[model samples]
Target: MLTGNGGHLQHLCAQCTSCDEHAPSLPPESIVQMPEQNTPSGRSSQICSDRRQCIHGISRQTNWVVRSSSLPQRHHIYKISNHFDPIFKLEAPDQISTDGGTNLASEEMEAFFRRWLVKVHLSSAQYPESNGRAEAAVKSAKGLLQENTSKGGALESDKMAWRQHASHGDQRVASCVTGYLQLKEWTNTSGIDRGYGKNNVKILHVRREGVVHSIKEYEINTQLTLNNDKDYIFGDNSDIIATDSQKNTVYILAKKHGIVSPEDFALLLCTHFLSKYPYVEKAKIDVDAYPWRRIVSEGKAHNHAFLFSPEIQHTCTVSQRRGGSAAINGLTGMRVLKTTQSAFVNFVDDEFRSLPDMKDRIFSTIITASWQYNTVDGVDFGKIWANVYKLVIDKFAGNPDTGIFSPSVQNTIYLLQKAALDEIPEISKISVTMPNKHYYTVDLSKFPEVGSLENNEVFLPMDKPAGNITAVLGRATKSKL
Candidate 1:
């Protein structure tokens, strides 16, 4: 039964009438009158009712009722990991915080329980009346998680176990529980950019392609203090042309001159590289120009572009990775570090997970710079350096996200870069490279596959690609570590 925003119960018939002393009122489309008390089947919470005055045994109404009746129950699950705590708290403090606190504070007891209660009112599933029942479930969950971790199962295993135990009843209840659990899991585990964290990444390579341009300019005819007491006169005129990845169209001169900096020059190069390309929303510039200098004549700096010898080589790279669940990568490889002070511990245990000692030191990172802007306006080198400097030092000393870390070098790099981008607001994205070394073990077994165990084939090579690949994520840079 339903009413306008609320409910309105009318009169109830004291006795059931079998078409006696009652003119058979036409069976209305729906029933609005209250149930009579004498009937075997009184209004047992109105299986289905509307405001009309008809009483039908059953009717097909909204699909929701049918769907609810056929739904399967689900139990909500969550993680209690080292990195899980800080990420839910500090990563996006503004967005994640509720109730005026940085911690993962819940609004009410129900709110807290609701996250794990998939089928809240399932007819078959039991509801925990006291904290003890919840605690017992948690203990079991923790054990399961620990077991999974010890067996090297992924975090998803923990969540899946909870889901498998949820109720299977009506569709409505099942859907509600499924949605609630998923939301809670995602909210808890999803990084700033969906579920991707540094652990989900691979490599970041930043490259500065080439700049193309031609210049014709005048030389400085200045009288300077020379060894021969002669006026040091530089060339009076010059003309040159060059091209590279960026076809920086250069005007000879005498036209409108634009203010240029290191960043500006870099942008010019990027503009040329991307102008004729396809599917590029924008280009990120990286200026790894070999250090070049101009002559100082008569106490004035001469205006000249630094040129590298054709025989020598310099390197820079730019890339992008964008999708809802995909990583955002642009430029990487500026600064990276692991602090000696951080630690990991007290993670939730499950059937397939394990927990390390809380006191054991865990690694953290301060990724230096994100990607350089490949544009003429110029990158804020000052800002880039500032972020790099601060993160390199601060990430180690302060709390860093611990969830994403692993003993593997790849995991560390990914997590650090992710943190750098996530923690720092300015940096938009990062690209990264991680190397994995294969440690080979001597085959002591007399026979090959016949006697060999699962991990018996120990082979370690520093130059191998065992899941080590470059990752290019965007929306990284200039952010605090």
Candidate 2:
């Protein structure tokens, strides 16, 4: 089956990210080659028409054949409001576009979409024909990708040149689909960070005797991956770290490091792994820090009290190879909105453009700023984080009494990144991802008394079909957003 990239659905991002759990699947019970005739299989166009006539007989099943889900993402998307979504733990998209397959084109599907507040766009019959049956093409591409291992340069042969034009969506979707292998199916990680040892994760809390796991519930999560030549090349557990040791080290390290910030803690973990083991040539660490604020009671803050803050989160990722410098990256999520002083105007217009040019409108966004630090030693990460956080919000709203004008989100991102680089030398570069959260003025033309959102001050906020704007600014080159 050709699985399309689910990038538009933000919830799928986590599922697509690489994890050791999706390691190389064991060899299937049976491996069957493509049939000589290339005859179409009746099993959704894959299996033979008659089970008894087939060579494998009635015992044959899909799990018997070697398979790969490395399919290219079509320009369009398919969304069904069926058990497929809820079983996958999705928040569901605001709209769905699909090929007019018999399964998708039905009153029940339309009713489900409408009841769930989902917009449905059905692709024309011709579109599906143009897309065509891609299973053979996908299988060919997957074979080529697996066979070639030339250190990732330009493809040498003319036959492979077409991959240069393949969209990133195609490559990403193919790489990450092998998640949680089936009991009898075979799969591989597509030569991306393969691991064979036990991989364990820990959520920090005082795990000592008489200490409830949720007492502190700091909500800090950490994962460590160590690599060396022995385990990977020799196929022995020589350099492998035990599961118990990993859990113990995580707890002990938390007590030693005191959890200053995610960046610092992640860096510390990376460095320790590199230093402690001679076999560990490379160490990568990921840490997520959640917000917990001390409770304030009666004009004073409680020392031993706190409340879980779920609005925003901080993430730190650190990686280092032995005898190499460490790379530290941090991300912060913040939400801010302004009622006025924002406008989006004069955009390139075509037949699809229906939005009238906006002016002095309400603009809001969930800000995700990703930055890499050039220097980590003797740096005050806490203070720098605070300053940068304040700076972005302050820049978003200039002269608090009356905010500054924002002509476009692109310009605002560029300005803030530029300002941040100017403000802090420790940061090497900054990339800002801000999705346009829209608030449309309630039309009062029916009443004929509100005077076009002037007399009646009311608006409706939307959470879907958000505009995505992102750019990176660096010391070496200032990117044009």
Q: Give the TM-scores of the predictions, in the order they appear.
A: 0.25, 0.54
| lDDT (C-alpha) at residue 188 in model 1 | 33
Q: Summarize candidate 1's per-residue lDDT along 406-429 as a digit string, tens digits.
A: 444444555556666676555555
Best-matching candidate per TM-score: 2
What lDDT would candidate 1 get against the real structure? 0.30
Overlapping backbone residue pairs in candidate 2 total: 1
List the lowest-lDDT window of 10 residues for candidate 2. Answer: 48-57
Best by lDDT: 2
Tell me how far candidate 1 lies from the true structure as C-alpha RMSD in angstroms.
Answer: 28.5
Per-residue lDDT over 413-449 for candidate 2, one digit per residue giving the tens place of the 0 to 100 score = 9888998899999989888999988888777767766
